[model samples]
Target: MSSVCSTFISSSALSIKPKCANPSRSRSKLRINCTVGDVFVFSESVIEQKAVSTAEPLLVSAVRGENVERPPVWLMRQAGRYMKSYQIICEKYPSFRERSENVDLVVEISLQPWKVFKPDGVILFSDILTPLSGMNIPFDIVKGKGPVIFNPIKEAADVDKVREFVPKEYVPYVGEALTILRQEVKNEAAVLGFVGAPFTLASYVVEGGSSKHFSKIKRLAFSKPKVLHALLQKFTDSMAKYIQYQADNGAQAVQIFDSWATELSPVDFDEFSLPYLKQIVDTVKQSHPELPLILYASGSGGLLERLPSTGVDVVSLDWTVDMADGRRRLGPSVAVQGNVDPGVLFGSKDFITNRIMDTVRKAGSGKHILNLGHGIVVGTPEENVAHFFEVAKGIRY
Candidate 1:
């Protein structure tokens, strides 16, 4: 009998390979056939796995603090709504949940930008809230309104109804898609996985969707502190397991997104957000010491000093903070990613090029991954994005 693995069937990423002076820069088409007891390992098959992983991606090398010629470049939301290719797929699939939940669609959508521009990282084409359904929080991504939670969790009893996620069980398509991504990208770029931080996930569930004031969740946090902590603890536990599961399934690195964490005052962040983020980091590190964990909190200018304490390998900086200052505050131990205003992509190609230079110069080389401060905004010109990547990948020293 032939041994089987779960690589997604629709494998596509620029069949035409580009030539590079440093052959190491080109992504090899990996065949994941690492065998153990008639089973195959996804990321373990390549020589890169055997001897310091020969095909170790630039992104991986930079994250690990290795010497490198240039900062690895990829954008948050590099895939999805901004790409014409992705929007075309959305037309056919018609459901955000289905597009993300199905392995084939996930692989195809994730590769859309990769095939076109080949960024230094390929993030899984799934949402931060993707794990919610698995955790028994029913939700949907609306066309215009954004994420909706059918039943908001409040009180101790509602929190009791939540389930810890088992990614292999609930979103096996995710693992399957990731395995397919690793095979397809061939370690040319780091394959990234992401999950919502405890506070962020709790905000969506408690507030029922996107909120400007974040008043509902803040009310819960400020008034009913214990009840909120109980809910947050469940998410901390669930997301840590989710990160480990992603790594096992072939995610080269994972990012934790706390999109709403800045809503808390420093005192509140310490009380509510910091400890849980720390717990997730501690738990995952114990299990996969070599795996890299990245943490991003929007509007984190106030909290940059406190971020590195979570023990994450990388602390992603939003545009609100200057790259040099963010770098100085986070210090030399942890790697830093982003600080470019995503809005910069909308400027002239020359303008975009100049900004990249400024960011790279400030980051001071190595221990850096060049990226947009946040997800590429919708309606950004495709040609400019291509130009951004062209200029980014061409840098030396």
Candidate 2:
């Protein structure tokens, strides 16, 4: 029967194609039949099981931190600014402008990383300013300075100018991108969706872009705590809905990027950042409890102890902190990700391999995800990335 089934259906079904399955949903059963030219034969019993979908298995499994034969590897900014293919694509769409402006292009760009790296997952290819663009805040990604806000939110009135809920139209771009990604990439890689945390988002809005000291945001946090809270509340509400939109579409897991949380001390983080961040995490988790949510804060070495309390499933560390020390500080409740310096990718392959091996070893035997301390630099050597993974796969532990 099994031979008959293989003979009938194997020809048409074995061509590698992308498929998606939501573990939260009911199971899908598959049956086999053999087709010898025109003759058909049935297999044993109908295969009773969950759907045979093609979405990457490793990424989804890693989100749950399930013990796997090997650790899945992918980098921050895995989807952008590195590959020659990506540059060529951008050159083709010269006026494509910022990523959020073109959903189709954005989807294509997002898939580039997965195709080139064959990494375990694909981070969505949209900017951190994406949600703000949805809110109609005048923003643009400048060549060198990063996201430049044309309309900065300063006073209480300016806060009200932006919509409390992200516009519905903007939601589909992300969902559409995920749909396209699901169709494009082979099943071995997972698609990851991310949003900026409220504090980081608020800092951008308050400070009007990247900053040295974040003085304006700090003043707002200290002087007019209610206003800052209100802004954060608005962002938290919108961001929660935005993240949920991604999950419902096809994103296997989500991450909250709190890049500026390092700017705040522990007291300030608890007061101005943690509460709002917790709100977003709690709300999102309520709906999708099994979906892995990672909270990554750049320069957040001081707040390691405070991270688990935010209700995040994973806490990503930056390069400033030692991974072993971070492991000790974080205890064992939440999985830890990252701490490899991205700059090290510019070093010799031997140097890169040693660093990757050391980080993997130092992270010890708890729930850990290997990643760069931050996004890859624009001109990183491809060989170094290859070497990094070679070391990762070669590590015994």
Candidate 3:
């Protein structure tokens, strides 16, 4: 394995500069103090660079089933809320509301995770509600409510009233952020973009926010199947276009966040949720065949059997399920990501290390992507995060 030794440099020490070679393969110089034995091994596939920036593609070939010595790692919601640097940057702005709303701030926060973690990828910093906000849905992030909608979609007309798809300008913020992240990240890591799945987005819009029972959405799905499908279809069309937009600009991969997909019974999921998800995935694939697509469904232990039918390149499991069990059920074709309970991060370093090792062992020898089963809970000790990666780096397939 190739290695480099150097003194650690602060993330800010790296500067993004204009590229003279192919934009996708260009490298920038970064200087760090280091010793003779300090080693860094990059995938032979990555173009060597003197300095790292967002311009280099994140190491996605591993996720696509390519073998490499070091396993790639990145966290869900790696950007914002979790990092002190992100918090400090946000403080410079007036409010969390103002900071998240601004595209430039969003890009800056998104890059913060990359700077700190040096993860294999950078997920875009925007929330799932961004597209809805662009659609003029009148939504806001209430402290406990998650997302509160001023006007919920109760009927077909309400769905019709909202534009069926995102207009380019309304959400140009995402594209702008991607462009900056692409240039800033360079080949050091891959940049990921995401959208809420149709059913999940519909759940927030239909239920008017977060829900424990999802009674309203369930009732609508069963009682007014046509209306639900219509809404789902519209959202599917919009999400497909949204994901494609990200891929077009520079995202190496995209994820569909079906955070609420676990709430449905398998039968209901097949009827109400899977169809629209298939629609979006299929449509997006038509346009960007090579882009990796990850479909993450939280609390989806019961529906693991049905996931393979969805056509997602990767399936992200929640913490409750055993990784080995999920691998067996989902079979060998799909790459498996995550299943470590975020709560585990709050425990002792030994506990976290043991758990991560167990997960790596259970994942067996096939395509596997390392990630938290869910997001990193805010206020987690940063040392725990570091230990998780440290242990993960030591594991062998």
> Best to worst by TM-score, what's the order?
1, 3, 2
Ranking by lDDT: 1, 3, 2
Q: Which candidate, 2 or 3, would have the higher lDDT against the true structure?
A: 3
Tens digits of per-residue lDDT, candidate 1, 1-397, equal 0011221111121122222221122264333322222111222221232223347889889999998767888989887878888888888988899998998899998988888887889999999999998999899999888999999877889999998888888989999999999998877788999999999999999999988999989888889999999999999999999999999989999999998999999999999999999999999999999899999999999989999999999999998888999889999999999979989988876567567766776788689999989989999998888767765665555
RMSD score of candidate 2 (Å): 12.2
Q: For this target, which candidate reaches the highest lDDT against the unseen true structure?
A: 1
Best candidate (score: TM-score): 1
For model 3, how big is the CA root-mean-square deviation? 8.9
Candidate 1 vs candidate 2, lDDT winner: 1
Q: Give candidate 2 misplaced runs (Cα > 4 Å).
A: 1-56, 94-97, 394-397
Clashing pairs in 2: 5-34, 8-34, 8-35, 56-187
Please say which candidate is ahead in lDDT: 1 or 3: 1
lDDT of 3 by residue, 155-237 (tens): 88887777856647778878888888888877777889999999999999999998889999988888888888888888888
Candidate 3 Cα errors over 4 Å, as ranges: 1-59, 90-97, 394-397
Residue pairs that clash (backbone atoms under 3 angstroms), model 1: 48-53, 48-54
lDDT of 2 by residue, 1-397 (tens): 2322322223332232212222222234333433222222222321231234474466566556576544557899977677787778767765435555577788878877655456666878877777786686777777656778888787888887878665357656778878777666646567788999999999998888999999999988888888888889889999999888888877877899998987998888888889988998889889988778899998887788999999998888888999889988887778888878999999866567556656665776446778899999998987667656644543333
Candidate 1's TM-score reads 0.86
> What is each predicted model's overall lDDT from 0 to 1?
0.82, 0.73, 0.74
Instruction: Give the CA lDDT, 0 to 100, for residue 162 in model 3.
Output: 76
In candidate 3, position 160 carries an lDDT of 78
